[model samples]
Target: MIVCHCNSISDRDILSAVEWMRAADPQTIITPGKVYHALGKRPECGGCLSLFIGTMEKSDSLGVPAVLQNLRPRRGRFAGK
Candidate 1:
């Protein structure tokens, strides 16, 4: 299924890109821009943004790296505010 008409990006393209990225770097955060770059294309119209995101969500490898997960600092943890 074609997700992005302007960029000629398909669901399969998105999935493949995601898997490749995950394999290359387990700690990498996959994004729409990266997918476009992987496919040698760029988004023209914003119409497909939602659908593009939907397709990306279907990938099993699409998740934050285990080591990098939940590294954010909690609120009010720093002193001298």
Candidate 2:
């Protein structure tokens, strides 16, 4: 299941990278670029983005951490504290 032909990245590779990253930092946002970096590779033509993203979405570890969820600015108006 090759995801990125240019970088020789496979589905398993992406999953492993995601798992590793999640294990390393539960709060880190998982992205294609970060997965590529984790696998020691980089995107070439950006053609595999759709499939790459698709594969990433399948991973259970790929989700925003609870601590980072619903973090919206409360009203704004903090003029120098």
Candidate 3:
């Protein structure tokens, strides 16, 4: 299951990267760039973004960590700014 043709990334590779990152740092935010770096590759053309994101979303470890969750300053907090 090739997720990113430009980077030659597979679905398994993405999941492995996600799990490795989650295990390494529970608070770290996982993104496509991080995954590419973990796999020693880089994205090209941006053609695989949709599929890449789709694959990443399938992994349970892809979610934001509990400790790092809900820190965003929404409407009320932003009103003062």
**Top candidate by TM-score:** 2
How do all models score by TM-score?
0.86, 0.87, 0.86
Note the Cα lDDT for every prediction shown. 0.88, 0.90, 0.91
Q: Which stretches of candidate 3 lie over 4 Å from their true place?
A: 73-81
Worst ten-residue run, lDDT, model 2? Answer: 72-81
By lDDT, the better pick of 1 and 2 is 2
RMSD versus native structure for model 1: 4.1
Native-to-model Cα distance after best TM-score fit, residue 34 in candidate 2, in Å: 0.6
Rank all candidate structures by their lDDT, best first, as comma-separated numbers: 3, 2, 1
For lDDT, candidate 1 versus 3, the one ahead is 3
Evaluated at residue 46, the lDDT of candidate 2 is 98
User: 26 in model 1: Cα distance from truth in Å?
Assistant: 1.0
